[model samples]
Target: MIKLPKILKYPNFSRLYYAGLTSELGSFVTETALMLLVFKLSEGDKSKLGIIRASFLFFLTMGSLLGGPIGEKFNRRNVLIFANIIRIPIITVLFFSKDFYSILLVNAMVAFFTGIYNPSRQAMINDIVPQKEISIANSLFGSTMAILHMVGPFIGALVFSKMQGIDEILTFDLITYFLGIALISTINYRPPKKESVDNVQTSLFYDLKEGLRYAQKREDLRALLFNCSIAGFCIGVLIPLLLPFVTEVLHLSDREYGLMLSVFGLGGFFGGIISHRLTSKHRPGKLIVSSIAFEPLLMLLWLLIPVFIPNLIIFFFWGVIVFIRIPSQLNYVSETVETEYLSRIHSILDLSFVVPNISGGIIIAFIGNSFTTMEMLFCTAILFVILIFFKMFTSSSKALFKSEAKRVTRDQSIQDGIA
Candidate 1:
């Protein structure tokens, strides 16, 4: 008999979790389909891939800027539903988009609405799950995301190879959004107690201002947002580099490429489990900094040893570090941020990531072709190291590490006394 994760025992959370699984799977599928479609349409112009991704993510960033305010000011459930509904036409337009520019435009539109959906959904976790279970909840969400990220793209690619048409793929994506809407509708949420008629009456602009102010007032959040920007840039650089590295450097086929992602996803799945189990034992911030700091070092090492099997092992470890970082970061935020500002703060975090993510795409687009994949990857490693060094110096990180140090010292003192 299987025992469910404790977080999943909550009825509302279970429903929302399953709903997220469906929507997230569709989202990854759509992303893969769009990438393939644009690649073919542009005659394998790798630069265009960067352009499409950057544009898609740019609008997502912009939309997120507004999404936080909108989600907080209006009914969150309604916000998610409306975002899903409006996205239908956007995905439909992809069927008609033939040129690179048109495809980019349609994808950007889709990203914007999807962006709106993300913050609301992230913040919604608080409404459905108990406060004590937040870490487990985040870990579960992270694991689902890792699994879907691998499986969804693999499914999309398999279908595309067989059908050899973007239209069918687009239709599949559209259907999923409808399913997402249906699932979202079924979720019953408990609105925040801080939400009152008076507070709700405030203008979206006012809420937006307050959200920014809230983040501005907090040093820890400011550091986290800054860290996000650095991660964003590294992520931007990594995305365009991965396929080329696997295929060109490793001299492997598409199947090998998929296997690489599968291995990473497997690592991420276990990482989430490890993170969830450790929630009771370690500080979230300690887990976050420890996991995140070591990740880039693995990236640096991966570049040094380029054989396929060894690199597969490396990718797995990288994935574990990532999953550890993700849940710990989310848990940290949940503990600190007020429920009222949760959506907006998440939106800000998204923007911090996406803005540099767009820049990363552009870097790969222009600077990438000039260098070999290995060389470009080395540059990525350098950026990641820089990001980590930045993390070590942040005030929040110091405090987190300090707290862990004190705990260890106290534990040792008690053992000495017993002896």
Candidate 2:
């Protein structure tokens, strides 16, 4: 057996890790359950299902937008605990919801709180871990979530197979949340110093605008955000269409679909491990950009390849590439940005996906029913490929160079101060 890192030995981080693990496991279960429920409620109407999903995302985005300041200003631990606590009742309501709209409403509410939970948790992680160890921390954190994502679906499948209803799964989800609350309560954390009462308070709008101004001033931050935004848009387009592609285009069974998903998650787990081990030696930004750039080409390949086995193989690798960049990507942000502004920055980045998620279906719909699925996919792939290269080479090249120089200078200053 491999020896555990010394960081894992820290009781507080360990507790926090377990809390996240349980919460993620539960979320995945709920995710699977929600998907199934939506399918049932919509009677497998793809359009309606999309609407439900979009609804949840809309509220989530709004929550994230508003939650950023709260995370930055408040006690993150309390915020996290409250977020989890509030979710219980919301999920409980979801359990008993018989109507589709009720389910949608409850889900939206839950997602709203989730938006709060996520940034608070992320900010808290930065507080708990030292700057030097962030990469390892993220890798371990990413790996745990990936593994849970891989297994949770199976657990959901098993439970669904046994119970054949959403109720039992919801109950399990509630229990997991409770456990998460219990686990996280034990963690010791310190919030930043409060602003002096004598100082004039900035309005929320002012604070938000300030964050935007800060981001705008940094060419690298802007470039990175642009890259992330594009990536999120492309990903959003792919997510809603994956099930249909697997079932209709690939002609795969539900079992095969589940297997494909599991394999994909497994790939993510390995990718996280590799990222952790290689962080010191590798150019993470390059690796991340390269992986995302390759995604379109990979999708195109998956679409063109007629063989199911080959497609699964391609998809597994796709998963690896998808998750492999997360730790690096996040580490880059944490390393580049000031701690005081990190949560707001995360919230801003979260919008990249949120906007795309809400608009993806509309984009798909406007293209006309006459186009074949393959044609649409092909066009999307080509567009993403072009856009990605253009963004990297034309738009962000100078920014990246500037950011690198700035980072070096900052590091030197810090070292000089220490010396």
lDDT of 2 at 123: 67
Candidate 2 wrong stretches, greater than 4 Å: 1-3, 194-198, 362-375, 395-398, 401-419
| lDDT by residue (tens digit), candidate 1, 65-148 | 889888786778888889889988877876766677778888898889878888888887765666656777899998887787
**Which pairs clash (backbone N, Cα, C closer than 3 Å) in model 2?**
none
**Which runs in model 1 stand beyond 4 Å of their true positions?**
1-3, 195-202, 402-419
The residue-by-residue lDDT of candidate 2 on 167-268, one tens digit each, is: 888888888889989988887666755445579776656666777788788776677677677666666556555655666787764456556667778878
User: What's the lDDT for candidate 2?
Assistant: 0.71
Q: Using alpha carbons, what is the TM-score of model 1? A: 0.90
What TM-score does model 2 achieve against the real structure? 0.90
Best by lDDT: 1
For candidate 1, give the lDDT of residue 202: 79
Residue 199 lDDT, candidate 1, scale 0-100: 44
CA displacement after TM-score superposition, residue 362 of candidate 2 (Å): 4.5
lDDT of 2 at 99: 82
